[model samples]
Target: MKPVNKNDRLLVHVEDLTHDGAGVAKVEGYPLFIHGALPGEDVHIHVLKTLKSYGFAKLLEIENASPFRVEAPCPVFDTCGGCQIQHLSYEGQMTFKRKLVRDAITRIGKLPDVPVHPVKGMENPWRYRNKSQIPFGMEDGRVVAGFYQPRSHQIADTDICIIQTPEADSIMAGIKHKLTEMGIEPYEEETHRGQLRHVVVRKARATGEIMVVLVTKKKKFPQAAEALKLIQELVPETVSIVQNVNPEKTNVIFGDETITLWGKDVIEDQIGDVRFEISARSFYQINPEQTEVLYGQALEYANLTGNETVIDAYCGIGTISLFLAQRAKFVMGVEIVPPAIEDAKRNAELNGLSNTLFEAGPAEQVIPRWYKEGKKADVLVVDPPRKGCDEQLLQTILKQRPERVVYVSCNPATLARDLRILEDGGYRTQEVQPVDMFPQSTHCEAVAWLQLAE
Candidate 1:
């Protein structure tokens, strides 16, 4: 690692935002990443960490006004570090995000070809978040739940994040207060001897019933019984309350040992008159409104007809499969997690959607199973994790050679890399649409439609 030499407060204008919540600025003919600044704003920044080509900076003073700059909704919008786009006008934020997708395609994809679609926005930006994961910790012998500030490991106490339902914010104060009264110390990762790690809350947009899951490292808190008992009484709409004890130090969720203390473990959400079930660990878009638009775009671009058979790989709980099932002749979903597969089946049965079938196994095993059984799908939708499609999976996809491949991805680099595999396997890249799932953060989702080349 080379030492940073230039650390000067330069009058630099923030031109854009990097995918991971850093503001882009050109200082002295070099790119600088200034934290806590917005695009279209000119600000004097204090250069902090630097490299040969690029550096990071701290915002010092505003030199000029950006027409799109807006006062952040949350008081801790800048400090609590939850959202980075709160300072940017919602429309301007969408524009910045569109550029992010375009830039990502240019850098990751070999060819800059597809037109990045216009970003979709919501009628109400505030309270658009359907879910909120609040990090819980013991701060000075008290329980606090919120998000961490940008780049800092310490979790900042977030009172009100603009993304989620107001109920989520209202429940935070009560959660901390009750946990302290119960003598439950929030989990401390460094010490590894606290009761709570985080509070995962979800709200049904239609019912307003919220589900709260308390994440901890241990099973039994001294106040576990009483705390939940009180929570049910205080927050009546809190339909399902559960506890997840995650002992491992890794950031992965502790969903393996989930015990529902009250109500069902899942909630119901409807996307354009079609209802779907969301389990605690199931992958559902956080922003429901954006999800409707995203799914609609995906459905539209898929161009699926009633005659087509679709395969939805990595279909967690069959969100996409069931969504597309009604339009397709039949839909098959493959998932690695058996429990999720079971949930998918149950979801399908719950909604009386029998046209969709779910299989539990690695894509390598399941895809081959379908292949050996001489089953062929006309369209295949692959929505893998940020790591994207594994080589084995990609090989299986090639072998199967579904006529159409719809890849819904969270990471652009991985998506591009996977696209290259398909390209090499005689598939041509088709239209790609970028959706802003996470507003204030650098993370965004892209729906890339892939078609087999003749």
Candidate 2:
């Protein structure tokens, strides 16, 4: 019989944290997940819902708070779904992330002996994000813009987001106010009857260049000129103002056509010594400073001596390929997105790099063909999506037999699973380094180095 019921108020002790940053407390071995609660704390809670084996609870009161708990800085921390662990101290966040990685590697991968190092955290974690994609909606006949409410499409209206750069906040405020003043209706998802859909702002930290992308339901934005002028006046760092038309009635933020309403089509940004031309759709890392650190760790794992070949699989815009090309004999990068490959080629040319080649195809298919055509890689680096590397790619890595492998991951459970596959395929994981790319949030990026066994 279940020990908890709906509307049951009970005192429980939080024992651990879930991957989504929810506190886990067991009532007679039946786990209950509570938000706004941390591990090692006693809290009074009301059961909201119950399932076959688990339940969800609302934190009524923290009878005994953990030392790591701190006041969340953001006003909408509870309602906004952007950040999950804002109430936890930064120090506690780092420790939790490290344990998050360690536990995944140990439990999921079943590799208990693997060395999981401490997370490399930022000194000032606030306002570190360079890109912001905020959705706009109407509430009470006023245009509202901010992050979506938790698990819903409702926009939590706010002018400031502490994680995004100040320029993004300013640009969003200006655009929102201008849209209201210009009688532009915010796009309604249910009816699909409005004009503006979303506003994606990218601010280059290295160079104070900013790109403002106005996503609308159609291309006939008659007030594009005024919107551009307002953004330019609001922030002097504005370099590009573009309009992306998404006529579909779907949840996707962008659509097929992009028109440069004003300014340049692409803005310039730098990471390490490599400069990149970021467009409205480029997949540049949101956190540039930590990106350098993550890429640097991958570069170090490669241990290039300018006499070996490297293959960067799932390469987006040649970020890691360009980083490795500076030291390797040659580097070949492949991605499934053709436009990303074009951007990669453009970025390579922009950086005056000639030894790197990027192709538009799946890493699994392209790499095996490369191996068959006498183009084998000495080092293979993969930075895959949250689902981790494809099984075909893992098989390709084993067949190619690279001397070293550097796996950069944004999801730990998938990383652990992939690492186990590589370990069984004759590669020994040297170490895994966790990098806190998104602080005050549960997300963490890790880079693992592996060597082929003799």
Give all candidates' CA lDDT scores. Answer: 0.79, 0.94
TM-score of each: 0.92, 0.99
- Predicted candidate 1 versus true structure: per-residue lDDT over 182-216, tens digit per residue: 77777787787777788888887766667888888
Among the numbered candidates, top lDDT falls to 2
Q: Stretches of candidate 2 above 4 Å error?
A: none
Clashing pairs in 1: 19-442, 129-163
Rate residue 189 of model 2 by lDDT: 98
lDDT of 1 at 140: 68
Please, what are the lDDT tens digits per residue for candidate 2 over residues 250-366?
Answer: 999999899998889999999999999999999999999999999999999899999999999999999999999999999999999999999999999999999998999999999
How much does each candidate deviate from the true structure in C-alpha RMSD? 2.5, 0.8
